[model samples]
Target: MMRTTTNSEITKGIVLKAMPYKENDQLVTIYTYEFGKLTIRARGSRKLTSKNAPSLLSITQGEYEITLHNGLSTLIRGTAIDYYQNIKKTIEAEIIANYLLEYFYRYEEENKPSLEHYQFLAGILEALDIGYDYRIIYAYINCFIMKENGVELMMDGCVVCGNHHVDAFSLESGGFVCHEHMHLNDLRLPKEQLQAIRYLYKCPIERLNELHLADIGPIQKIFEYYVDEFCGVNLRSRKFVKSIL
Candidate 1:
């Protein structure tokens, strides 16, 4: 008996990263709109004359035609759609763009299809290319990922008492705390900052221009810490991003 494999199909996605593989090949991880994350082997992509080499670069969004197999998929060819060159031209945008790619590469499961995740990532990358504030975009990404992973901090009301009048944010408690329920040492943020976080969770990336935070540092730090503490994964690129900021 012989096994039958899936036929070749085209997927549109951004190349999260490509690792050099055995002599002249590369293993490319792509987050696709139809098939979620996929690791495809690109034979001869490392060579200078390889036509697929340009399309396989990190952060390049394109259509990839691949033939699926039981073990691993092979990339037949790719056509570049957008290079997002503007992001590569700026240092801050570039670092944040890499961080965004790293986030999806770390969290998204391979072969699980999710249109929502795909669109969200695409929008973020587009925003970076258009010169949006990287700090705010980074914070937004952190907020969205935490919520998707079921570790989102509550901002609507008190996590403990359900009081609408909250005075502080508690990392341990996992959300805002009402003054009545607040611990003595609970971190206090201005009321505006609290509102900013609430908006961060619900607002789409395209509407990011409307959101203004006088100082995004504190809230951004909170989201980063929340992810580190609750999600239980240390992003390797996070330190470099932080240093440059």
Candidate 2:
């Protein structure tokens, strides 16, 4: 049996990660705006003379020409797009960017395109490039990712009893629980923290800078637990970012 090759398609994407393939080739995982995540082999990408070399680095945003052959996509050409030069200048920014990229790479199913997810990711990178508060940016992106994946936190009320005056969050229950229904191990979030989580869910990312978040520690912990418990994603970049902070 012979598999016919598809015509080359062009897309805009960011390189999530790049690894050395056989000899001069490079295996790159990219999150494209039009086609979602793809693992494509870039032939001779490591060579000095290769035109695609610059756009093959992890975190580089570029236009890619890909052709599907025998169930594998190969990179025919790449033109550098943003490169996000500002984000690469600082270690903290780089770590945060890497963590976000790694999170997407781990959870996003390949070839399932979501324009919302793509725009959310691209906007986050742009935010990081322009030097917004990274912690808030991280929390915002996490909220968007969770929402897009349909695991958004149940913030309306108690997940168990439908109580509007919820006071605790339960990792086991996957959302907020009323004081009466709260288990012994459930996290008791302060009133402000609960409000903050709700705001993150409702507010747009562009308005993130307007928020006067006193502390995001509790909010971060809640979402981190949610993603770990539900998605089973354990990102190395997450640990690294935490260690430095």
Candidate 3:
């Protein structure tokens, strides 16, 4: 049998991170919408005269022309379509965004991964681009955890008692519960806030802010604990993010 090269066109992607290599070469990890996340090294992108330096630093919702040869992909040319101007200036957003990027880079399979997760990376970038709410970012992370892992969280009723229009929540049991089930290790989730989380999980970008969260700390902590301790996603960046704030 003989070997042949395969080439294809990909939709668009964001540069998650880039590292300098050799004298004037660089390696970049990109989270793409159509193809999930993958790494493509630029031949000569480390020097001042190189064109890719700007693109490497230009992450967050940036779209580009990714050329794939055989089983390898390279950034032939790229342009920053959505720069996410203030994502860096805002420390909290930057930390959370970078943490999300780290998760994508660390967990996503190079060749095969869920494409929706890739789209999520772009969506989060867009969300951060528009505003600087850390709570919103946290909500997105929780929703991402559920969506990516194929875990369905039923928020309508208690896992133990089948209560509807519930007011409290339990991470252990999944979601909302009635007063009789308060001893089931579920946290007290207010109705309005549970509605906000529900909205976050299902609503589109335009309607995310409709449910104004007075305080997302408790909810965020609950999901974070569940994600890190129970679900086994221990991101060092998450630790760092916690240490700072």
Q: Which candidate leads the pack in lDDT? A: 1
Tens-place lDDT digits, model 2, residues 44-156: 99999999999988778999999955556899999999888888997777888898898778878888777887887888888889888888777776776576566866778
TM-score of each: 0.92, 0.84, 0.86
- Error (Å) of candidate 2 at residue 121 is 1.4
Off by over 4 Å in 3: 1-11, 70-72, 113-115, 243-245
Query: For residues 89-206, could you state the per-residue lDDT of candidate 1 as single tens digits?
Result: 9888889888889988987888887888888888988999998888888898888878887785677899998999888888788888998888976889899888887888888788
Ranked candidates, highest lDDT first = 1, 2, 3
Evaluate all candidate structures by whole-model CA lDDT and list the values in order.
0.85, 0.82, 0.70
Looking at candidate 1, the ten consecutive residues that score lowest on lDDT are 1-10
- TM-score-sorted candidate list, best first: 1, 3, 2
Instruction: Indicate the residue-level lDDT of 133 in model 1.
Output: 87
Per-residue lDDT value at 35 in model 2? 81
**Number of the candidate with higher lDDT, 1 or 2:** 1
Off by over 4 Å in 1: 1-6
Q: Which residue runs of candidate 2 sit more than 4 Å off their true CA positions?
A: 1-6, 148-150, 158-188
